[model samples]
Target chain A: MNNKYNIFLLATIFTLCIFVLQSVEAESESVYEIRNNQIMEPLVEGLPDPMNGREIVISRIGNCLACHKISSIDESFQGNIGPSLDGVGERYKEGELRLRLVNPYYLNPESLMPSFFQNKNLVRVEKKYSGKTILTARQIEDVISWLLTLK
Target chain B: MKFFLSLLLFSLINSVAGRTENIKGINDNLYDRPYSIGELKSGRNFLQKETLEMELDDFDNPGMIWVERGKELFNSVLEKNNLSCNQCHNTNKNSLIGAPSNFPKLNKDNISLINMEQQINICIVDYMEARPYPLESRELLSLSAYIAYKSKGLPMDIKIDSSNEKFFKRGKELYFERIGQMNLACNQCHNHLEGKYLRAEQISQGHINGYPSYMMRWGVVASVHRRFQFCNEQARAEPLEIGHPDYNALQLYIAWRGSGLLFESPSIRR
Candidate 1:
């Protein structure tokens, strides 16, 4: 009887473990809902990790420094093509920032800023990177989080 | 306080003397440095201190190797007419001094721009009755460097009038026109980002007062045409041929930009 009970316990534990694993996976893969130029905060807590976001903003991958200047980073020279990104967080909400990162042209047709999370309507894409976003969804979230800290 | 003031004054003078303006501005002429609201300085001024010191060291500069080889080649007799470059142009009074400072002239016959190397080819093919050296060949590069070396300190004085105006305009348009997958024009970086870091390197006024320049990246002497190919490739654009007529016109315009700067051919770069 005790052996049978032990078998039943083991079966129960295995089923519970599967349920826990599925919940974690579902949480991580949750789709974001954007409305009226604002987006929901990231479901994956570490994705738009503020630290990694800062790194991306400075690299050629973001090329933020190429067109926009950030007063925080004290470098010899900065570009003035785009507005200085000082206090950008205070100026823009999380949703607005997310939309800009995903596709600036969606908001303003003439915006020169490239879409980091979508890869349509671009020119001269190399074979290696064709039909791919400039950054992953996680990178976009991270940059958004980092930009929010500018205030 | 005095030391700081002197340092400031020194930098001020350098900032003023290191560059010049066409006075008429960028649009009307091909000679002006585009996107520059201020004076335009040579790329030489932006070179690192160590690089500048290396260029000043005449004996150690790697470009000297090509220059020396060029001297030997200039005197080498062609079996055809017992002629050499020395036979025609290397005279005591008419020595090649300042010869390189003025070039890319309009060939009256074809109405095409003829640079120094092309002019050398003309002499060999027509005057000496020998075959022309292939473009960018070691022999040609050597001869070009040797001739450029003769004009080391002379100020740039290239001629530009009706004969070469159209070519100059074409070059100016090419400079401002964005290219490659990156979609960056020369003015975007060389002008807009001057003194700023792009790919982690300083941008100077895209001047080429120093041709047959020794770039540390190539580890040998490189002509201006080779460098143009590099710029295009870096932007992920298809590079034009080294001796393309369009490139020649661009060269003519850039040389004019270095109007007052002394020729520092065989100079070192990194």
Candidate 2:
């Protein structure tokens, strides 16, 4: 009985370790895609990228919720500064979004929307995050993928 | 074993029930009062019920940690003037009632608008004959929290006379001016949709009575200017330094907007 219990305990520990490791991998894994037409190429990891995009829509990461409202996220609070993104898919082409995602300033110099992928020309980035893009290329693509499904 | 499990379950139920009862009691009068311009509800009122409880519990309130640190620093002697804050001001906090609310007004000299943190540094430089504490220094923040802590519950009484009129006007412009790559003005989030939520966080009027308040996200207390810098940065504008004149002017304006709200110094925020 004691030996059986020891085996059971070892199995549980191994399973727990794997579960934690997988979550960490899920959080950090993103592939950089080389896009021909985007204003700036995004880090594109094709691995279940849509879920990543949905999170970015709702999260402080993309801060999309700060300006645009998305309907399905089940989060009760959303802002109205930008247009509601419920039908964003029907409105703009993927190429247009790619431009906006990379840097909205290219399309409209006066636009207040932040560049999700570009880093170099940003103003007032905190010192520790100076060179960092708000969202990785993969993250931008994930957000775009999710935004596309909104229509 | 069965008895222990049952007791544990019973206690948990009782505690949860007790907490809800306490919340009901507290929430009853928080935002039910008459509203007026410059007479807005507190950020505390907008807090989620659970967070409000965390702030109300003095022993459990995280901001009290900063207040305690400030208290300690208040009694400690300065290296330059051999004078501690308690040497001049009342060591007993109650004596400072209604004092901090009068700030961001003209100083005795009527030269520049000064907030609580600036007043602390001004005292250090003018009276202690010591160098002003560097802006946003932990020592300075602690003292500011302590002094302002004394004035908790005092209605804001900032004066907007000739001495501070220009600063107040400039600060008002800054509040409404759109900046940052995000092109957000302070009024867009705070004035327009204060009840609305952003990223699940409720928008408050962006008042500053709570500084050097503790932010759970930062896990540290921050000065008012630090919060301003964070807001500017989030708006994608270049955040000015902690003591920039623009931020100071903004602070003055915000303080005036929260004119009648009781102080909640070292208040907790998400």
Off by over 4 Å in 2: A1-62, A69-84, A88-149, B1-35, B79-82, B91-95, B107-111
* DockQ scores of all models, one per candidate: 0.06, 0.13
| DockQ score, prediction 1 | 0.06
Worst 10 residues of 2 chain A by lDDT: A26-35
CA error at residue B124 for candidate 1, angstroms: 2.9
Give per-residue CA lDDT, model 2, range B1-270, as digits (tens): 546545744653454234322321123332222236545877887887887888888888887877888899888887776997787787455356677866665667766667777888888888888778787777788888877888887777676777778887778767766555454567656764677656567778777767778888889888888888888877767788776777878888788777788888778888
Best by TM-score: 1
Estimate the overall C-alpha local distance difference test score of candidate 2: 0.70
- How much is B240 displaced in model 2, in angstroms? 1.4
* Native contacts, share recovered per candidate: 0.05, 0.31
How would you encode candidate 1's per-residue C-alpha lDDT over B75-159 as one tens digit per residue? 9986588898887676665588898765777775856888888888888888888988888888888899999988888877776
Candidate 2 lDDT by residue in tens digits, A6-93: 9999999999999999665434432122234343434444553788888877877787887678787777767765678888888977
Cα distance off (Å), candidate 2, residue B269: 0.4
